[model samples]
Target chain A: MKGISHFLAGVAAATFVPGVVESAAQGSYLIVLGGFFGLLPDTLDFKFARYFEHHINIDPDPANLDPQIIANAVAVEIDRAAETQRAVRVQLHNIPLGPNRWRQYRIRFDAERNEVVITIGPIVNAALAPLDESGQRVARAKTKAKIDYTYDGEMTADIWNGPSFAFVPKAHGVEVQFLPWHRAWSHSFTLAALLGLITGVLFGSLQAGLVAFLGMSAHVVEDQLGYLGSNLFWPITKGRSAGARLLHSGDAIPNFLAVWTALALILFNLDRFSAPVQNRDPLLTPWVYLGTTLIMPALILIGVYAWERRKDHVRREVAQQADIVAELKETEV
Target chain B: MLSVIPSIYLAAPDETSAFIVLPGQKWLLERRGYEAAILTGIGSLCGVIVLVLLSPFLTEVARTLRIILSPHFGWILATVTLFMLMSEWPKGGDRGPTNWARFRAAWSQLAAGLLTFFLSGLLGLILMYRSFAPVPVAFVNLLPAFIGLFAIPMVLTNLIMGTRVPLQHVGGSIDVSPALLLRGTFAGSLGGLFAAFFPVVTGGIGSFLAGHATAQRDERTFIISQGTSKLVYYAGGLLLFFLPGLQLARGGLASMVSTIYTPGTPQLYYTAVAALAVSGAVSFLLLIPYARFSVRFLARLDYRTVNLGTLIVIVALLLLTTGLSGLLIAIPATAIGLIPSFYGTRRMNCLGVLLLPITLNMAGVGPDIARLLGLA
Candidate 1:
């Protein structure tokens, strides 16, 4: 779920309780505070924890100067290192064009072919373009380069267990390193409880603390609905809990429904609190509210889900036809 | 005319409209422009009709509620407005750019959010302090805020961050199918009616709900619906103020009108409706030429230069309308406004500044907190 969806879920949970709305009218805006706390877990992970994680470096063999040659040699080295339970590294140099202009490249490891491929991307200019011989623009010109290398190492089985890589430019060369594990202690339930407790203590209210706890818990649970589950037990459990793969964070319909429902409920709660004393009649009757807040959203969700599924089906059919055509062409060749 | 200018600017910028129109609808606009336009026209016409029909009942409800809720009305309005602002906050995505670049972007966003927050707080304090006679018009401050927060940023971003505009086919006539036109109109009018009748509800929200509820299968229908919804939300909302037995002001434009000219007659209501129709038609005709000119102009010009010029114009306007004090308030408001984009959260959260303070006041704790902060 996106941040808005999670925030709204926490808000919806708080607003579901009529007491919270009533209390809001009486000078306690704990529900709003709860909504803020709901956004805290993700905020902490992305803004703070991400920076602290160490990058794993993979340095390529110094003998292989060309990226293509280095990629091939590194692939073989990785396989051997994985089998020996040792780390392998790679080093790629930035392709310099001028005083400050250069071409940066990225490396991708192809697991199926047991190979590595290098592709040069966009040009970066530190300053103004130097005129070419034709007196035309030179800085914006495209660079086209692609290289592939195969590996025939004995340790193909354990390559999957090895760390992922990100290429960063250093003075000597580009360093490829694995990014550290995310959604660990930062996403744990234990941390949420501790944070809530501390917050409550600071505010001098147990209820406030409990609201924080609930908000954080709601966020964790919502995340669990997606593919990237959080480390629920935290220190007690070292790994993430594999989530129910019903949807992804980027699924538009689910995200929309979550935000829409939350907002509607919040509005209903606000209307309840702000209504005049003499007119006790609710603006929306129970049935209407249910229809708008629950049933209607549910129906829309289903419609979107079905539409996406149909689109996926059509796309897959077309892709399969293309694959078949390509295979036939290969056979003919 | 007052609402039209800002509304057009807000709507004209593709960025905000991108949020309103679904992805599929944009594709439809590019491919089947005629169908899209027809659907939009039908939807808008239906929305206007619905607003006209519902004005009497909605006005009565609004009037009754206004009398009953008058004491805490300001607080409620302030709270909701804050929330609305927060919802508009932009988010920084995990992808694209290096850490340093991302950090700079985040810092700028934070600065903008903080500026908006403090400025809004200052405005609240001023309202609390004394009502200025010959008060600045409602949009005097709001227009600059919109331009600074929404317009300038969009223009700057498109200039700095965007790629060259690709050549696209633009000429087309309305040739929508009857079924699509009806469905689009019905859905749009329904949403527009909800916005027209409801408090704190805008056309954007209404159209969003309608789009989802109808599960519009095509981009053409969705685009049409959004078009109708916006018309109803803006023009229809204003028309409510002219209603005979229920001459109640609903939006900023209506409130300003009420401040200047009293509305009480059925004749005035009919006249206003006629005027709305005439202005809307004229605006629609003008939109085509203006949009075409803007596209051509923007494609050739350097975005950075345009952005710089826009920034200067906005600042000048802000100073002229609100003076030094308004500029001071705007500084903080701008910072707060920038937060949503930096944090990768919905800008709507900025609304918290108003919602939190005003809601607290309504609940009777606001004054105490203000005193604690020494604002009181």
Candidate 2:
């Protein structure tokens, strides 16, 4: 199934790349159309998923990991007060700061038992560590937070409403945007892959995994090409920018014309070699059309061949297993 | 339209299709205005090839000029290809190279290869004059080129076998015959040329008629019951023909005149329309009763547009060819000529599949290599 996806992708690339190149002077819109076509299936599925969660409310929480909070706590640094003033143990407040208007908070809770010890580490100090220790630092921080806030409202609020936005588990601080800082990182890839894997497991096949991964990845990639940026390297960088500029909005016309040209070439010259426009006659764009037409058919054939081979291999294995079982039965007799 | 000559009579098929389906017709015709775009693309591709090959002899900027003018080039290729196809009569046993060898051998003692070339050129001229002038010339120009490229190997292979016999099955045993070999060779060469040029012309017109009949039949089935008056059938046929012809001829006499190659008056469109009107009225009169019988006879058959179109086209072509043979005999032709001509035309129709792709590609001609060949 994974092989199938790779094969389809190859076919698409083969057919579409030549088609785009043939119409290259026309512009990027044609390529964009190809990209959109690639992502069409997943986009439809994403809508379905959205409807299921928001409308039907069947399993609204996408994480589907830990449903109940396990622990909640607040720290204290107060002396006893009398009368009108209660004991001032701790204060909790959200401090607003960044471009996302993200607010940070710090609070301490009094412990009833010394058995449950408290530990606090430096926030920015993890950046100074060796690469191996970096994971440990983040893990340690998250684990502590999980233990402290799991049982309470603040933890639920943060879980449901943080900068992190994903249908499945994603690293903290990742956000969804039309333009992401990087590509395929942050929230998109992880959630898509995880969901797909889960779906495949439940379905007893890998098709779901392929679909999930392709759809999610395409979505992220599409956004990454936008004017604003995406958080492509979520775990690595706590930064986001508006423009990483892989594509822009001005390339619509040329793309359309190019596609039309490609379709024409495909229909007309199913077999004959097209004139190589770039190499010889610039006016005669045979090679481009030829390449475009051949790519899909060739890739499809390759995919079919590989699939047949796999099927044969499976058949052989089954036959061999049957033969071994027969021998064992004969020996037993 | 040919009926005005009175001597130019057409044979009616035993049964006409109430419906039709043409190969590739649905894809081409139903594509909105974009059908032209697709046609242009195919045309450009073919045209561009010729342009590039001939660019060296033209201007330095010929290469650049070719791309911009590719559509026109495509049209030229399509048109020339069509002409090449129609010039030959396909023989059942002869394939091109193999047949050419026998032709050469039959005249070998006279002048050897010189006679063969001379005869070929003469045949080319005859074909040119009969079909209109320029078309045959273009066919001849392509003749030497095609022979050099493809026929030489085939001829050599045929010669080594001692007898230029083709594969034939007889009495449960495989055998070859000289006559069969010649027939195959002739058919192959001519068929290839025809297929390369006018796919639609050979079968398309017939197919279109059949298809129109089928569409009408389907529409009729919805509108009335089989128990209805027989006149309904004729009416349906008339309606079908008139609408399509009118739609096709809306540009009028200008369109009809354009097909003449040598331009005359602008009234040719009116002539065609008028001719069509007369034909429709006559066909309607003849077909009314038959249409009623067809419903009962064809009750068991499913008459979709495609099925009707196919049946109609085959029947129409068969009748047309037969009628042509009949007309050829009126003056001085022998029985041998009539029978052979009928068979040849029927066999030649096998080449009809090649036309539409070639022709549509040539429409709206922007740039084409056929122009250099003087075929465009």
Candidate 3:
């Protein structure tokens, strides 16, 4: 089940990586595609969780979804040796995304099995979806009867693991990690490496590795691009996310590239061509692409430099105050 | 010269002696009252325009001519311009070229332009008011200020003219000199040439003052060293009294408010302004040829005494124009005309502190008088 879940996760990651890159190169129209495609797997993870909760006998209230609480409860229940009449539901209850940190999990808590399996979607995707049975298919009066409904039993479904879970912060809402895990691929790297091996059996190692790497990296980058940040130090700390509110919806690199493509289209139409065409994409003007791409980084760097200077000044003043307090204490002694 | 014109015309003008006679005779004196009025009105209108425009131009021409013809002329021009610029608000200093020499040289050009327009405006008003038949008694009452304005521009232009380098090299060998300087022993004297009626353009006021000075003593001397007598000084200072007319024309709300009370309505105010501007321009045109001719004429004669006699004769002629002419009309007209000039003078100076007090007083105290009289 773990291997199958991990493979499904790899496949999902594979779909997103190329989509984001292609969209970025296509200019603004595809930027919308990139944003939607980037959040798809994350949203699916929560949907599976909701499905699990409904199938399980556990009357898990959808409103009670603090990761820490779940972690503590699972720790206590797992450690106990009683005939725990535990009912487990792994769910992703759909809830409206508000102005706060959010997480959607494909969570499974088992008492008899003594196992807790949980996977989280990107923080940006934790939002409510309508609870409807129309989405799930059921066969009636068939030769092979299928147990389609499990509304009063413990959930036994294997959750699909995607590359997005690679950077899901360790239990969420803890600041032990220095930088966002989203910046670097976590579980995505291993998944891509394994997928590359499988692809090498079918295709060639180089092509498979390139395709898998590209797919896995795109998923990681897209999740990181969102404001919630990603867990880049995944297996080690699982408590990493990075990014500020500014430019939160996408990675700076892709956003910069998308803007460059749009600008190139505009400049190309005007016929004031300065750079040689890379490909015969008549829409592609090289100067605008090169200029905007180069200029934006410099501008962002300058802004960062100024912010750091001001921050350093504030730190110095704070240190001075601390020194004064220390001296006062010394005198008191 | 009187006999050179047909004697029969002067003898035949017996019918309209009352209307035709003007105070100073230049040509025909006898004419109908209506003809006199139309001519005087047109002439006054023309005079005003010329005074406003040409005055500044003439001052520039003088500075340019000096720059071209003389050594250290720039310093002299600067000194004169600054002195004229600073003269209005006299700070306590020994009054002489030596004491104020440095300052005089500093801002001379700007001062010259300001003072020239100022002096010409005064003269235009005096000339306008005097042109009226049976000059008004109220103007006569304000004679000192009127004559002072009319007189100041003349004195300064002549002083400027008299001091010009009348001799300049033309084509390397020959000196082209002013004609007035060559005419006779008395014709080229700087003092006398400056005093001439035709030569000095700022009404004959300065000549009149200089003459007054000379009359008190045997010979003319430096104004600072010998000192203009108290009477002459007061007469010159009385020029300030004309500020009311100019103030009403331009200064504060009173000027705008006075539009209602001004005799002929707003049209008349415009007409008066237009006339002064026209006259200034015309005067400017007439003076250029005259200045050129005089420079060449003066170049021919010996420097000792030729120009002085001619200038003396000219000053004598101007005296006849102002003295016999009704000061009753000319004086007040000039005084009223000069108020705007004080504003001009104030703005031209580096420090305009003197105008500040005067402006406050005029804005403040002038209204109080109007209120006391219920004129407000």
Query: How far off is each candidate at the interface, as Cα RMSD in Å?
Result: 13.6, 32.3, 47.4
Please name the candidate that would achieve the greatest TM-score relative to the true structure. Answer: 1
C-alpha lDDT values of all predictions? 0.51, 0.26, 0.29
Model 2 residue A307 CA deviation (Å) reads 5.6
List of chain B TM-scores, one per candidate: 0.65, 0.21, 0.23
Badly placed stretches (over 4 Å) of model 2 are A1-281, A284-287, A301-333, B1-254, B257-346, B349-376
- Over B5-50, each residue of candidate 1 has an lDDT whose tens digit, in order, gives 2232222223223323343333332333333344455556655555
Each model's DockQ score: 0.05, 0.01, 0.00
lDDT score at residue A87, model 3, on the 0-100 scale: 24
Q: Candidate 1: what is its chain A TM-score?
A: 0.64
Give, for candidate 1 chain A, the lowest lDDT window spanning 10 residues.
Answer: A152-161
> Candidate 1's residue-wise lDDT over A1-333, tens digit each?
655566667766665554565555444567775666666676665444443333322432223324455455455455444444443333233444543343444555443443455543444332112222221111111111111112112111010112233333333322233322345676778987998899789988776677777777777877776555668988999655666555554454665667667767666665666454434555656578778667887897768676765645323222322222221111110
Docking class of 3: incorrect
TM-scores for the candidates: 0.60, 0.20, 0.20
- The model with the greater DockQ, 2 or 3, is 2
**Tens-digit lDDT track of model 2 for B1-376:** 1111111001111011000111111111221112212221222222222222322332323223334324233433332333233222111111113434533432232232222223333323322223331332433332332222222322222233221111111122213233222222222222222222222333123222122111121222111111011111222122212232122211223234335533223244334345544554454344433433432443343324323454345335433443333222211212211221222122112222223323333342212423433444
Off by over 4 Å in 3: A1-187, A197-209, A222-288, A297-333, B1-376
